[model samples]
Target: MAVEHNEAVVLRAIKDLVIEPIPVPDLKDNEVLLQMGSVGICGSDIMYWQRGGNSRFRLEAPMIIGHEGSGTVVKVGSKVKTLKIGDRVAIEPGTPCRRCHQCKQGAYNLCPDITFCATPPDHGNICRYYKHAEDFCFKLPDHVTLDEGALMEPLSVAIYACRRGEVTLGSKLLICGAGPVGMLYMMAGKVAGASQVLITDIDDNRLEMAKSCGANHTINVNGRDKLEVASEIEALMGGQPEVTIECSSVDYSYDLAINATRQGGCLVAVGRPSGRTLLPLDVALRKQVDIKGIFRYVNCYPAALEMLSTGKINVKSLITHHFTFNETLRAFETAISRDAKAVKVIIHCDQ
Candidate 1:
C-alpha cells in the first residue's frame, strides 16, 4: 500500500505559515517525490520575510518558499533507476528541459525553460514532500549529512563563481563579505588550489568566522573609508589581488573590489546590490581589468557534492545556527539581529 503524505507549508500570502494535510502529487514517469528534511534559509528567503515580497517575486498568491534544501527519496517513478526509496539526496531546484540546446551542450544551467523549485508563483521546496524530476536530484554519500546535502546548493554557487573567476593553483583571491556565499567561495578557492584567500567584512565576528572556514587573512571594512580599507587589504595580502569576488550587496563594495584588485586583474560580483550604482568603467578600462557578473549558479552541484563527500571541502563550520520549522519567523528575525553569530542558519524539518 502507498504511504499517505501530508505536510506543513509556509505560505507567503497569510503573512504566516500553515500546517495542513496535502495530497501528494503523483510522480511522473521521470519524477520522484522527496521528503525534505533540512533547508537553509537563503538570503532571498529573508528578503521575502523582511519585505513581505522580494520585488516582483512577491507572494501575492500563497507560495511555498525554500530553495537551499535536501531530503530523502520516498518514491521513484517507473523510469527512475539511479535512485530508490530512502536514498538521501540533494534536490536541484531547477529542472531544465533536456531537449534544449543548452542541456545538450552540458550548459543546462543556461536553459531558459527551467522549472525551478521556488521562484514566485511556482511552489518551492519548503513543503514536506516535493516532486522533482529524478535526473535532477543527486544522491549523497552515507558519510555526508543531510545538512551538507542542503549546503550543496550554495556550495554549487561557490563552484560556479570559482570556475567563472578562473581560479587556479597559486592564484591570489580576494572575497568581500563574510556571509555564507563568501565563505563557500573561500572553501572553493582552496579546493581549486588558490595560494591565498583573503576575506573582508564590516563585521569582525563574521571575519573571525571566515578565518575558521579557511580564509588566510581577514579585513574589517567597518569604520574605515573605502581607500583606507582597500589599503589595509593590500597590506594584508601583500599587494592588490589578482582576483576580487564581491559577495556583499552594497554598491560601494563593488568599488572597493575594483580598487583592491591589481591592474589587468578580474573582478566578479557575486552579490546583488539593492539597486544599480555607477560603474567604474574608466578605472576598469584604464587598468585593463575585467569586470564580470554572476547570476545564481550553473552546472556545479555534482562537483560540489563530490567535493563534500571526498573531504576536499567541509562547509559545516558555517552552520552556526539552527531553527525548527515552527521557528521560521524567529529565524528570520535572528538572521537580521546585529548580535546574531551565524554564518549559515539551517532549519530542520524532520525535527
Candidate 2:
C-alpha cells in the first residue's frame, strides 16, 4: 500500500513549530521509502526553532527538522539492491555529489554540493514517512535497537573528532563540555585507547553523568577562570592532554581547550559557534597548538555501527527522554528546559 500523507514536525519560522501533513513523494530509482522509527532531537534543531538559523545555515523557509534518525524500509526503488522492505536502518543524513573532488578524495562530508537533512533548503526525516538515498542508509544488526541506530549520527561525529585529534594508545584527552556530543567524545576517546580522559562542563549533573559513563575525571567549570580551569584539567589528567576536543561553542571553552592542550598537540573544535568569536591566538601560537575543525563526519558510519554492535560503546545512558511522534512539541520543550536535564530526546516516529 503506497502511503499518501506524511505527518511531519516542521519549523514554520523562528520560534514556530507545528505538526502538519506533507506530501510523500514517489521513490526515485536509487531511493527507498522509510517508515521512520526513531528520530533524535539535535541541538541544531532546537536552535533553528528558536533562532531561525545557526552560524553556517539559516531557515529560509518552512522545513522539516530532524537528522539523527532510524527507520524501517517500507519500499525500495528498482536500483536499490542492498536494502529491501522490512529492513531497519540508520540514516546518514548527508548525501554528497559523487563526482565532486571532495567525494572522490573520500572526504565527502566536505563536498560543496552536499545536501544535508534538516539544513536550510533541505527537508529532513522527522516525518512518519520519508525517502532517502539507498546508499546513505545502513542496515542495523538484530541486536541494535532503533534508538541506538539513531545515535549512530552523533557517534559518527565523535569518532571523526577523535580521529582528527589523533586519539591513540596512552594519549591524554580533554573534552570541554559534557553534553551528549561531549560525552560521546569521551567514550570514543577511551575506546581509541586514551589512557586518561577528563571532561568539563558547567552543569554538575552533566559532569556526574560523564563520570558514570567512564570519564577518568569530571570538573564543573561554572564561574571559573579559563586559565585556572586549564590548570585544573592538566593536574587532574597528570599533564596537558595530547588532544583537546571542544564540544561547547562558548568562547571560554575554546580558550580552555587551547590552554589545556600540550605543546604540538591537536585541538579539534567540534562545536558550531553562533558567530565570529575571538580566541587566544597568541597562546595557541606560542604553544604550537594545531587547531582543526570538523564539518560533520566522513566514512565513520561503519565503525560507529560496529562499536554499537560489539557493545564497545554504550549510548543507552545518553537517552534521557522519549516521546511519541505526536508529542514532538512537548519533547522539544523538555529538551530545551534546564530542569529537564535531557541529554538525548528520542521521538518514537513509529507511533
**Candidate 2 lDDT, 1-351, residue by residue in tens:** 678778899999998888999988688999999999999999899899998997779899999999999999999999999999999999999999999899999999999999999999999888999999999999999999999999999999999999999999999999998999999998999999999999988999899999999998988989999899888888888899999999899998998889999999999998867778789999999999999988999999999999999999999999999999999999999999999999999999999
- Model 1 misses residue 43 by how many Å? 0.6
Give the per-residue lDDT digits (tens) of candidate 1, residues 44-139: 777765566663466677667788899998889999989999999998888888888987997777787877766776777776777888877999
For model 2 the local lDDT of residue 131 reads 93
User: lDDT scores for all predictions?
Assistant: 0.82, 0.93
TM-score of 2: 0.98
Which structure among the candidates has the greatest lDDT?
Answer: 2
